[model samples]
Target: MTNVYLTARFPRIAFTKLETNGFTVDYYTGRDLISHSKLLRKVAKADFLITTLSTVVDSEIIDAAPNLKLIANFGAGFNNIDTEYAKSKGILVTNTPKVSTNSVCELTIGLMLALSHREVEGDQMMRKDGFPGWSPLYFLGHEIAGKELGIVGLGNIGSELAVKANALGMKASYFKPHQLSEDEEKAQNVTYKPFDELVKTSDFISINAPLTDENHHQFNAEVFDNMKDSAFLINVGRGPIVDEAALLKALKANKIAGAALDVYENEPVFDKKFTKLKNVILTPHIGNATVEARDAMAEIVADNVIWSSKGKEPKYVVNK
Candidate 1:
């Protein structure tokens, strides 16, 4: 019988589909990450592997899985897997894309609302010290409506955000390498702005791009300097896209108003210094953590595994 190994315990749908199709499915059940030795042992006898973004499927791991025919990633981003090496070895790599689009887009807006309205700060204040009284100016915050929103990288999430922002009475503009046609921009109700221009003119800046060699550390001290003193930064994309040190400096100097981050430069680890500032809002990378998104992602992964089990092409091949 064919064997399938899951690096972590995901939703049971994946296991059900594999097993229903006569494949033996086994997974790690630890709360913490599985040890490398344990992972090696698990994959060595596997015919297929399911991975999360947190698990690094590097060259060594790939080499150990001599019979591995497929590496199905649970998340939209597959940067954790060595795609080139897998392709070289004729191993198929797949990702569940667009499954988390709505969840992530909603979280992006949630982060924006939390940051702009100082919701987190207010909550902390209420818990630590009882609200003195509702004074007119005690918790003053600017409304998001009528504000200029500059989105970086007009991908699926970014496009959705533009529509939502427009509905909320905010003006949305975006910066991407390839500019959309005038007609396309009108349909999306977003204007195209150059990167420097968008950063300088917008009241809020959001990062929705992927992690790539050309744009790593794209937002640094200089970019922060160019932003308005009252502007706020929101990052729902990869963490390294913005320089954490530079962001800390900018916050300390009041170069910009504040920032909200769902991702960190390093996974499962972040700068504790950010906790000291009331202006900063941090989330534990829960952009796609909603139940609906996870279920959808699991179904997609299971579908791909089923297809590959029948010696057919999977629906979402990333390395193809």
Candidate 2:
């Protein structure tokens, strides 16, 4: 029987499934690993290591787990995992992809609407018990209908947002390395534009690209300068893609109208400046936190661990 280490808290169904597979599972729920020495001792014998975004699986941790044949990540983004190191050791790495596409896409649209319409400000005013008489100029915000939306990456979530944006009477444009197929292009009705041109001409900008070496800090001061002063920015993808300092400067100086972010460069430990700004709407990385999405992701993680333990390829192998 394979020895599995459950490094994070997961749904009971996933745990039950893993147990039924006749694996010896050791569970840990505390954010801290008790102690690095103790964790190294426990993982030294682990055959399959299952983790979440919070856990840092670095080279040192990998070296400690000599028996680790596979690493199953519970979420779609495996940026937390060191793929090259894992591959060199013949340890397969897998992530749950496409399972939370709808959940994330829904959050992206929600963020856009909230930021553009000042939904947070409106809610706060109502909660303050300050029900003053409504006036025409009271809390006026940008309208969503008949606006130009520029999407940075045309991946699954990006394409889905385009469809939703079109339904709201917004014209969709995207900037990507390659253009979509004719059928896909017609389905989304999005025009491909140059990155700088898209940033300059858009009424709203949405980023849904993965974080890679080539695209890190892609949105800096220069990119923000190109954006229209009336445009709103939304990011649902990885954090480091946008320079936080540059974004802060833009928001502070009113270089852009407003911004909404679901992820941050140094997440869970964000800059205090964002909290003070009313022009930005921030979320605690809950893009895929819906109950349905969590269940699906857990199921995928369980299946990946089971199959990989049996010497079979997983559904989403990162090192492949």
| 234-282: candidate 2 lDDT, tens digit per residue | 8888889999999999999999998998899987778988988988998
TM-score of each: 0.98, 0.95
On residues 1-320, what C-alpha lDDT tens digit does candidate 1 reach at each position? 88888988888777787788888888999998887788888899988899888888989999999999999999888888999999999999999888788888898888888888999999999899968797887889889999999999898889999998999999999999999999999999999999999999999998999888888999999999999999999998899999999999999999999999999898688999999999999998999999899988988888888899898999789887
Shift in Å, residue 123, candidate 1: 0.7
lDDT of each: 0.91, 0.87
Measure candidate 2: CA RMSD: 1.8
Judge candidate 2 at residue 206 and give its lDDT. 89
